[model samples]
Target: MTRVRSLTAALSAALLLLSAAACGSDGDDTPKSVAPKTAALGTLTPGVIKVAVQPYSPYTSVQGDKIVGLDGDILHHVAKKLGLKVEPQVTDFAGMLAGVQSRRVDITIGGVAWSADRQKQGLFTDPPYYSPPAMAVRSGKTYKTVDDLKGLDLGTVEGYVWVKSIQAVPGAKLHAYPDANGVFDDLGAGRVDVGFLDPLIIIAAQKERPDLKISTQYLTPPTAAEVKAKPAYQYFQPYQTGFYLPKQATKLERAISTEIDAMYANGELTELVEKYGGDPEQFLRPDDAAAAARRGVDRPSDWTPPAIAK
Candidate 1:
């Protein structure tokens, strides 16, 4: 009887050990359960998604603690779509890229064009929205095109692609400034013969400075390959500026891209852009899906819009 009891005890112990092992093994060690609660699909954690921005007049700006403008409006919509909440971390144009590169801000949209150099370090919006370059000069001169400034002294913003074109001219002396306002000031004071600024800012300046004149003609840089054939004038390509995730956030990247495409197809995206004072036609077509396909752009998938919490 004692021997029989010992055998039964050993069997029980073995069963316990097997049960314990089964409990501990989590199959593939993947998450067996989702978070008990989630804010929304696209919304970042509350107060997350730091945005870097500057006053790109008519598009985005900082007033008091709130960010305003077309891009701001679109971002607000993006937050709502993502089911995440965010507040703008306003900074100067010069600091925008640094903010994103350092992870201080999750994204930036201060009219930054998608250049080859930036692409080396950043991921831009799947499709560019708008790009209209302008020429700013003192009251008296006229620049029908960049070729007209062959022998002139021009002021342009440094670190901007526009400067690359302005600097390439054979006899064009370029003075680089830190900001758009500075560029205009230098040109107005005759410190530089001419300047290149964004069209919206140019319009804002005209409202404020009756003496500042801009040509109706848009001057942007041609592609590097076209430099030899095109005049050394500013010729901007369609720059689709949008939120950029860090290189590691592959999940977030795919999610945002998919949802954005959905928004575009539904016309919600274009409507929101227009509400913020942008020309939807510049970025989307009546049939957004077709438009995106034609442009070889990505579509939105899963995300939620941002909310304005009072």
Candidate 2:
């Protein structure tokens, strides 16, 4: 009987050990520790992100090989938020679009305007950065409002919605130019009595040529579709810029959208515009530069950046 009891006790001990082993998994069945793998944000990662940038003045430009401008600065901020290094590739305004489509760069930061057409090509983020006002002004007469250009020969870049808007008004002859600069130059030469142009360029031109007259009144509030319709028109207005990602770039798109929202919440975006050329009080949601700067941070010192309204 004693021998039988001892055998039973031993059997119970073995069963307990087996149960423990089965429950514990002996490090074999244990869940393997997932090594902290870095996220694959395409060919780009947390350390370095290649960007396509345009040397368009006020929005983006190259300063001694360093990409600099309101839009470039905003991309730099986005890069910083993502804990990534930035490498900016300078290209022509039209070429920047090609770089992004080819995946030669992870992103483009040259104040690209969002539009329904571009949406067909790839994904875009929410809330356009800036929409600079467009103005209809007479050649030599400084008018204060759209009413001033009511009977004048108002010109707009061909194929732009702004031109359509001008055409809607009776007696408003819409002369289409290949580019805004040409329209403005024509106005300067008196070939056209008036031209519609981005307000900032108008401001810059007005500063340089006081003899040129602009109606103080803006003809229309800028929209992203107008800016995105063509790269050529974008080169003229260049505001209402938004982030562009490859089609179905879900991870990268989500990261950028999150960072942009955080920036808006933190008010860092608002500060950038104040630093650039926009009114802080009026340009909060519709115009923020922080996202533009952070997305393209090429240098350690450029981690903080802003502005696409120029």
Candidate 3:
């Protein structure tokens, strides 16, 4: 009986050991150690993330020689999370887009608006923020509605969607310029009666030229009846600003998108936006289903990356 009891005790001990091993612990009820969470580094060049930034203040700007602003801060956060260093390349908006297309830079984050034309050229990560298009006119000009600007000259950046909106107005003269400075210059000089542009741009322009006044209302898409009546007019859409990535860099784009989604959830993106003079609530996209639906479609078939200049 004594021998049998001793054998039974040994068997119980063995079962306990097996149970502990299966549970990944020493029978002491201690929790198992978990591996630390690490960010997925996808298709990024080793050690460095080259960023092309347009000198758009509040979004991105050059202070002395260093890049700074909302997009700059966000880029730094993303690079840190990915364990990469940032190499900023400041240029005009067109140049920044070209740099991303040509692979001269890994990505760009200078408040680029998400447009169908841009989607055809490359990939834009889910929009991190949004801003509506606004109009800037001389202080003395009293315009209450988009239609009021008819018969007056309107200025806007060449590639911006504002061009289409201005074109839609009957009798309105549209003057497209290469950059914001040129457009604002014409507006200030009375060459153009109105400057339809980004709200942030309008804000900056107001600071520079106190004589300039921003409209109280933003331009919106026209009603169905208006669209039918004025088929030529393309109404202004809100800017869903996002990071631009190369066409071949799908993995990188996904990685960045994931980070952006997390940032929005955790309020980090809002913090950055507020830090750079933007309305956090207005810009943040916590639920962007439409953007997700359009994520990976519409790449340009005939597009080729530009050759990097030596």
Candidate 4:
């Protein structure tokens, strides 16, 4: 019943995006003023946002011609506020990374982890949520800590935030795949002893194969890592999920951040997340480690996230 409700809401959101996409603006390269308002974003196209997306559900997914997910729901409200049309293009992970860099698309979505290395590729929007990476192992196996993974074969998607940390694990063999499906497939087939991936993807995989014996465990790394120089490694933290825009799209980044802030302030973001099968408290709010990861990023010295009610 919950799944059906989520699907129903997702379809409704997708319809809203489709309607917005249909309402193209006249010859003007600015935010469109369809009804209520048009944001003053320095968009590449006039009143239209060409977005790149990979089909990662609960984040973003290709449902027919429209994109739907938690990210998509946020985008729907954001577009309505700014009076902009959404044009989403479906592509693989590489295309999502490259499309925004080349300015071929105004932005890209679908569970892009916030990282310093990837930020060098393009501008990343403020995160709407943060999710922990998962350690997928055979059911009943007691592998909880990083030390437990020694000498075992592990698989993860290419460009995942934990790749560096996983590689740093002594005696652990890392196999990088192009996408999440391949990682789980290999894990189920015993090609790899473990699968290191996003927890949501792990949930989806488990649903697909209920008979498969697998368990989801959150990643735990040491407080400080002298081995890896990265901040995520130093803290052993989860990544903030955000969007990638063209390198010079600072104004656009700020504009989008403002809308995200509004949603957070009014609890819209949390409600939307919860309705989509996400745990708002777990994934939406940043814990101590994630706060450390945030400080490591290039935000203003005085920067702070929306205050959660105690």
Computed on alpha carbons, the lDDT of every model, listed in order, comes to: 0.54, 0.55, 0.62, 0.68
Candidate order, TM-score descending: 4, 3, 2, 1
Candidates' TM-scores? Answer: 0.62, 0.62, 0.68, 0.75
Ranking by lDDT: 4, 3, 2, 1
| Candidate 4 residue lDDT tens string, 71-159 | 88888788767767787776656666666776767888777777676777788777877766467777777676767877989887766
Quote the lDDT for 40 in model 3. Answer: 35
Best by lDDT: 4
Cα misplacement distance, residue 269 of candidate 2 (Å) = 2.7
Question: How much does each candidate deviate from the true structure in C-alpha RMSD?
Answer: 18.3, 22.0, 21.4, 8.3
The better-scoring model by TM-score among 2 and 4 is 4
Q: Which scores higher on lDDT, 3 or 4?
A: 4
Scored against the true structure, residue 112 in model 1 reaches a CA lDDT of: 63
Higher-ranked by lDDT: 2 or 3: 3
Task: Write one digit per residue (lDDT tens) for candidate 2, span 73-191.
Answer: 77778766766556666554444555566555677675566655565666665432555545646544664434455677877776555665566545768788876677767777777
Over 4 Å off, model 3: 1-40, 63-66, 91-94, 140-145, 176-178, 185-192, 211-216, 224-232, 280-282, 285-310
Candidate 3 Cα deviation (angstroms), residue 197: 1.5
* Each model's total of backbone clashes: 33, 25, 0, 2
Give lDDT tens digits, candidate 3, residues 22-63: 453232422133212222344344455666665677668867
